[model samples]
Target: MNTVQLERMKNDKGFIAALDQSGGSTPKALANYGIAQDAYKDEAEMFQLVHEMRTRIMKSTAFTKEKILAAILFENTMDLKVDGQYSADYLWETKGIVPILKVDKGLADLENGVQLMKPIPNLETLLARAQERHIFGTKMRSVIKEVNEAGIKAIVKQQFEIAKVIIAAGFVPIIEPEVDIHTVNKQAAEDILKKELIEQLKSLTPDQKVMFKLTIPEVDSFYEVLADHPNVVRVVALSGGYSREEANSKLSRNRKLIASFSRALTEGLNANQSDAEFDQMIGQSIQSIYEASIQP
Candidate 1:
């Protein structure tokens, strides 16, 4: 396992050890402390705790909440609530729970419950659905262009509708369009942004504010065009197509730039400042950036 995973495992081990020290034999007590009992020792409790954690995670996100829940309930038999009478239950109550506890909670839930549980819209399930639907690399870029051309409002509406279905199924739907900037040169990307995206932004209504996944090259031109539009409310720039490492590097290097831009837009919206208020906001951003840069 990687360092992070190892650390998490260590933490989980610590939690389990603490629970053992607490003198509780019931599964609920172990669960409240985020401890997974060995499957052979307490199968029913292990399964139940896994179900509850999955449910909790799913409810907390915009996407993947519903589907994950459904998957857990239907595919994994997660919601069946074993009566603590079956052989599996005795095994789990005894020694069968270790494997269940060691694996990643989410993956274990999916693997164990997916087959028996009916698909539902919940946060964890929806995230799994998103992973299934994620069109990456070249395919993602093409879809972004298609979505932009079709109109962001339309795309937003469609995505929201999908999210609704995902939610209805008991999963939270995370509906972010993947943008692949790595496949195209900067000039080609700029052309797409200026020619296609600018026109789309000009057409948006004030009520349709949603976060968008877009690259930096696209941001400069798109913002420049949007600067003239009175209806556009806010913009959040995303490092689309960047790997986790690259995204992290960019975030560390330009934390101030990112924070300042976000703060300016947020303050402007909160104060109902207009495009004409750009000068004042820009001045505020300079100060915010400087302060953010100096923070330890």
Candidate 2:
């Protein structure tokens, strides 16, 4: 662990930028960026296109440590280069942004009201490579779609279990058990998640410091306790399916929970826009999210 990066994570007042769209979400992500499916011939070409998009975003004058504290990367992206530097190195050295890797293989079929992450048999290899590349941490996600306690419990359990391995490999883990925003019983599910998360916190040792990326709760300040938990490094909110404006408005109400938006962060960006237009749009997003993140 780099002490400087760890300290920055604890004290930073900026939000994270999620650029880690994996194979499952890449097509939709590309389409949103105004690149159609037929534009790319195969997975390799598709990823190359997405990487270019990500590089453009990363290279933007607005996307620096001044607003973005960190960024998450997909496995393929970690191996790619940006401006002749490895992605993680460029993020840290040029932009002053900490680099995090997304490690899950993606979610399994819905089970017991949730979708758990599929097994990552290659996690050790990924973690080792990330560490070698000067990456700071890792992120993995699972989804909760209902009010089933057993299912929610399982989600939390699986996340924490994987988190331990990541920590032992000498990296902080952002454990994301995303509660689907459109679920009818959203508030009830969040209530149970809070309880389950609190219970899970008890299993960690003093040296273990994990982070959380959660959905903005229906009620304001609902997750303040978790944000302030001693066992946690920090708490962040995912955009889920909200537009940038809606997500920013909701995020400002949740003190101590910063934004880690993906789609919302890049909502107005398009491959067709001129460089000036692209920079202006992303700059506006960075400013809004930065302000909301520092809300007290």
Candidate 3:
């Protein structure tokens, strides 16, 4: 990374805080007195320790551009406080790192810059850019979904639209629908997944594919209905308000239901595999589908 980007990563407050907590010794102390006694022993051992430590630290501390971007997107908080007073001037002075007030203006500027630069072209462009930078992995996509779920649909839709424009440009109109699962009942959720959405999805294009964002509990019934329609390319199941562990546990319990849908869709897609292998692939596919559904 360039010096400017490196500076931005190093200057992140959360990252700096994490580093401070990771090492009991402050940067000042480390520069002045060398390694702490508790962290090592003897002069020779300390020398060796410092060498090993420096190598490991450099390896761990060198943050990538994508990491910085992800942190800004996911971990940034907008709560401005200037001398216990809240005001636009105070927020401006603090650079939008406040707790209570909004950062709409600052964010608008950033979004405008991103738009001008055309960072995202389409789904393919986005994926290609990520892959070219070696950060387009399944895990990173999962992180994108998590960030999208945090109610940042405008940003997410812009990215999704860009991706669609790049990959299947002019072939079909891809609709990016943002579904809210907060306090929504099963019937309401099912209604959203029904023929209404299917017709809307089909209306996008003759060959357009629909990607649905659904909570874990809504997957079985949701897909069961979708399974009847052979046009659906994917059913991306999302875990609303669930941690990664909890989502995985819930998904595991519903593996059979997912496998059934996967099996049914596989025949339509002409992708052949054994039932057992199909189950595993469906699990992995569902994870990726969910990851891809939401933008980072």
Clashing pairs in 2: none
TM-score of 3: 0.31
What does candidate 3 score in Cα RMSD to the true structure?
19.7
* Model 2 weakest lDDT span, ten residues long: 2-11
Runs in model 3 with CA error above 4 Å?
A: 1-181, 184-186, 204-207, 243-296
| lDDT tens digits, residue span 1-296, model 2 | 98898888989889999999999899999999999999999999999999999999999989989899999999899999999999999999999999999999999999999999999997898889998998899999999998999999999999999999999999999999999999888999999999999999999999999999999999998999998899899999999999989999999998789999999999989999999999999999899988888998
Candidate topping lDDT: 2
Clashes of each: 69, 0, 11
**Per-residue alpha-carbon lDDT of model 3 for 74-159, expressed as tens digits?**
01111212244322222223232211110011112323112111232244543343233322111011011222222333434443
In model 2, which regions exceed 4 Å deviation? none
- The local distance difference test score of each candidate is 0.30, 0.94, 0.30
Residue range 169-260, candidate 1, lDDT tens digits: 42222233333454345445345444544544444445332222234443333333442344322222344434333433443343112221
Error of 1 at 107 (Å): 22
Cα displacement (Å) at residue 13, model 2: 0.9
Q: What is the lDDT of residue 157 in candidate 2?
A: 96
